[model samples]
Each structure stands twice: as structure tokens, then as C-alpha cells.
Target: HVVTARVVVIIVAAAMVVIATTPVRSMTVVILTVTPVTTLLRGECIELETLGESGGEAFCDRG
Candidate 1:
């Protein structure tokens, strides 16, 4: 089966919309094995960093 790039993009956009609207704390199912949109505020960049072996941070603090 050949999956076109356009289709994939549309799917991703739809998923992002869903994530953006839903509240983070109430979400049960993980979106693509990662946390849904919460750390990133409107007009912010999403950044992910590893603090320690088991510690990590996801935020939208650009600077």
C-alpha cells in the first residue's frame, strides 16, 4: 500500500488539532506514545530536554 505524503500531513494536522483543544491533565490515552499539547503555550516553541538519567522536561520557554 502506498500512503501519500499529503494524507500523512492531513492526519498529523488533525491529530495536532485534537491535542491542542484537549486539556493535558484529563487526557488518558497517550498521543503517539508522548504527552499531548500542554507544555507548549500559544505562540511558543516546544522544547524537550533530558535532565538526568530518568528526568526530563518538556516546555515552551524559548531563550
Candidate 2:
């Protein structure tokens, strides 16, 4: 029982460490991935606005 408890504690601690470390990396990856897409979309919206396309106003307003 004692040995099993110790092993369980170690495993839980290791899992906690991995859980803690994983999100920061993933958050950065998400932000990095999302930013370029938003920027590109915004740029496209601006171009559309300049060209006086009908639906361009809606996109720029959303951004």
C-alpha cells in the first residue's frame, strides 16, 4: 500500500508538471497562428474598402 501510494504521488506530480508546461506553449502557438490570419483578413477588408466593393464595409466594421 505504501509503495503504491508513493508511485501514485510521483505519477500525479509528473502529470501536473506536464500540464503546467504545456499550455503556455500552446497559447503562444495559438496567438501566433491567429494574429497573421486576422491581419490578413483585415488587410483584405481594407483593400476591398478601397476598391469600393459592396460587402467590404461589413468586414471592416466587424474587425
**Per-prediction RMSD in angstroms?**
11.7, 18.3
> In model 2, what lDDT does residue 38 have?
61
The residue-by-residue lDDT of candidate 1 on 1-61, one tens digit each, is 0233355455557666776787583244335523333322211232224322222222333
**lDDT of every model, 2 decimals:** 0.39, 0.64
Which residue pairs collide, candidate 1?
none
Q: What total of clashing residue pairs does each candidate reach?
A: 0, 0
Please report the candidate that would top lDDT against the real structure: 2
Residue runs of model 2 more than 4 Å from their true location after superposition: 1-28
Best candidate per TM-score, number? 2
Tell me how many residue pairs clash in candidate 2: 0
